[model samples]
Target: MMLRVFVTLKPSVLDPQGMTIQKTLAGLGYSQVEEVRQGKYFEIRWAGDLSAREERDKVETIVARVLSNPVIEGYRIEWPQEIPA
Candidate 1:
């Protein structure tokens, strides 16, 4: 099984890098773009025999502790739609 994680700045936080990209896009004539936010993506593959619930719990812990800063960043987990039998 594989799970995907997305770590991003909270909406209330400032994103200078994202702002810069948006400005550049306007300069490049892509003015239709309204906003751009920067973030990190992680893919975790599970090979253990753990149950789906256990796997999610483990990944959630890792994400909260090591993947993102709880103060300024938020994270979401994307579980696979189907598990192989």
Candidate 2:
């Protein structure tokens, strides 16, 4: 049982950092990459007693309330999956 929170900017909003990276890539001759957008990624580890659905909901609640700005940003939870051994 773990909790994960993923926060990202809304699609309509501009991501300056992503734009810079894309430009830099093009300068390096990587023209095949047409579009690039950046967002946040995080992996959180919490207790093991909570169910997957419960954990996701918990994160969702937090994201909606505080972690994410619904007007300018979005958030989603990651489901349980195998960890590398």
Candidate 3:
């Protein structure tokens, strides 16, 4: 199975890097660009034979425990041909 993880700061948290990128874009004539937020992306390819439900459980656990900080960051996972709950 192939999975994608996206980790980003929560809306309540401040992102100085995103702010800097936005400001730089504006200065570079990207006037239409309003805001920017930086994030982390991870791709995982698993060769396990687990079913979808099992795979989801394992992946969610990994994401929650290792991939993201729960306090100030949020994460989303993309499962192969499926919508995450």
TM-score of each: 0.87, 0.73, 0.87
Off by over 4 Å in 1: 83-85
For model 2, what is the alpha-carbon lDDT of residue 41?
Answer: 70
Clashing pairs for predicted structure model 1, backbone only: none
**Deviation in angstroms for 4 in model 1?**
0.5
Per residue, candidate 3 scores C-alpha lDDT tens digits across 1-85 of 7778999999999999999999999999998989999999999997874356786788888998899999989999877764445
Segments in model 3 whose C-alpha atoms lie over 4 Å from true places:
50-52, 82-85
User: For model 2, how does the per-residue alpha-carbon lDDT over 1-85 read when each residue is reduced to its tens digit?
Assistant: 5546678888889989888988999999999877788876767666643455565567667768877788888887765665321
lDDT of 1 by residue, 2-58 (tens): 778899999999999999999999999999988999999999887764356776678
Cα-based RMSD of candidate 3: 1.9
Q: Give the local distance difference test score of model 1.
A: 0.87
Q: What's the true lDDT of residue 13 in model 3?
A: 99
Worst 10 residues of 3 by lDDT: 47-56
